[model samples]
Target: MSSGGSTALKLNNILIFGLKLLVSAGSLYIVFSKNDMHQVGVTLTRIGPAAFLTASAMYIVSLLGATFRWKLLLPERFTLRRLFSLYMIGSFFSSFLPGVIGGDAVKAYYLNKDAKKLSLTLASIFMDRYLGYVALIGLGMLAFPFSLGLISGSPYKWAMPAIFGSFVIGSFLFFGLRLGKRFRVVSEFYEYFALLKDRKDVIVKAVLISVFIQIMSFGAVSLLAFAMGEHIPVKMVFLFLPIVSTITTLPISISGIGVRESVFVLLFGLIGVTSEAATALSLAWFFSSFVGSLPGLAFYIRHANKPEVKNS
Candidate 1:
């Protein structure tokens, strides 16, 4: 790329980052303006250090589960310990350094550099993320019927179905149609996809593990609610958390800070939770995950300057 083109791309990224920052700040402003700050503070204070540490530990366990699922999609050459390190580093980059380089890209870059098989490495990373999302959507759909009474009259009632429908259509187009087979790059990617497709056992195990990881994530959030002295039902947490997780994945705000808080207040409000308590719960959940990601910083520093070794 020419210097001018590179400069233009950097400027565009900067602009998008600025917009996301504004969105996060604006959303928080709106959320706090309408709720009682004193109540939110009080609820947050209810969470002791022990609860915070437990929540953080739960998040680490979920990351370990995620590492196992990703391992199922990769070659046996990648050991569990190595994969766990990569996962931690990826999480650190994702949670701590948004807009710099994405966690997935970081994982792919390091693995691809060593494995020297760009297509397969990239495909495995994609599959790891894809299966996790599939589990999240599936869980939300399963819980939708049970929670209909809670969202019956609200506009958000259709969100789960709409999201599921779109996912189904998109999946059909991508996998069924094999739309990009004509392109060399696309065909290379498809080669790895075909290999994974043939391994039914591996796919099933990965999906099951993904479900487990998602549930662990839900449990971590529930722990935070408990810490805040809010007795939100476990069923409601399972039902509503997936939807919030899905929406927060959208890149509308930084690290999902503002978007997550807004959704928590809205959904938890259905069960008579005050806006302040819900907001406190949301912040606590993020902080726990943030603490869990801190180890990735150490991994990054240790490995950042290491020379890459290409496997023959």
Candidate 2:
């Protein structure tokens, strides 16, 4: 690529980052302006240290479960310890450095450096993310019937189903129809899927592990709500959290800052939760996960410059 082209790409990235920052700030302003900031502060204070610690631990367990799921897609030579370290580093980058290289890309780069199979490494990373989403959406679908009373009049009544339908159709086309096989550059990428198509055992195990990971995430947030003296039902958390998680995954806000809080308030309000309580819960959950990601900084500092050992 020419210098001019590279510079244009950099400028484009900067513009996108600026737009996301603006959106986050604007949404946050709206959320705070409409809610009682004093109440939000009080709700946050209700969470004790034990609750925070437990939530943080649950978040870590979810990360570990995700590590195990990712491992199922890769070669056995990669140890859980190594992958967990990489996962934490990825989390740190994702939480601390938005609009930069994404956590998935960071994980792929490090793993590819050691494995020396860029295509397979990238494929595994993609599949790991894909399967995780599949499980999340599946859980949401399962909870949808039970949640209709809560979401009856809300836009999410249709939005959740629409999201699931799109995901199902997209997955079928990509995996069943082999959508990108004709493209030379991506043919190798699709080949990995072809190879794994018959590996039902691996895929099932990965999805099951992903389910466990999502449950742990839900449990973490529920613990936070409980800490605040909110008695949100477990089923409600199961239903609402997946929708919140899916929406926030979109690259619309900075690390899902404003978007997450808005969705939390909207969904939990149906269950009679105040905006203050919902926002506090959302912020507390993010903070716990942020704390969980901190160990990644230490791992990065210690191992980032270390020599990569090629697995035989």
Which candidate wins on lDDT?
2
The global Cα lDDT (0 to 1) of model 2 is: 0.88
On residues 1-312, what C-alpha lDDT tens digit does candidate 2 reach at each position?
999999999999899999999988998999999999999999999998999988888888888999999888986479899899999999999989965768988898889988788888888999999999988888878888888887688776776688898898998888778786887646888877778877999999999999999888988988999989999988888888878988888898887889999999998998899999999999999999989899999989877678888765
Q: TM-scores, in order shown?
A: 0.94, 0.96
Model 1, 44-141: lDDT tens digits are 88998888888888888988998999889987467777788889999999888875678998898888877778878888888999999899888888
Clashing pairs in 1: none
Task: Find the candidate with the highest TM-score and give its number.
Answer: 2
Q: lDDT (0-100) at residue 182 of candidate 2?
A: 83
Lowest-sum lDDT 10-residue window in model 2: 151-160
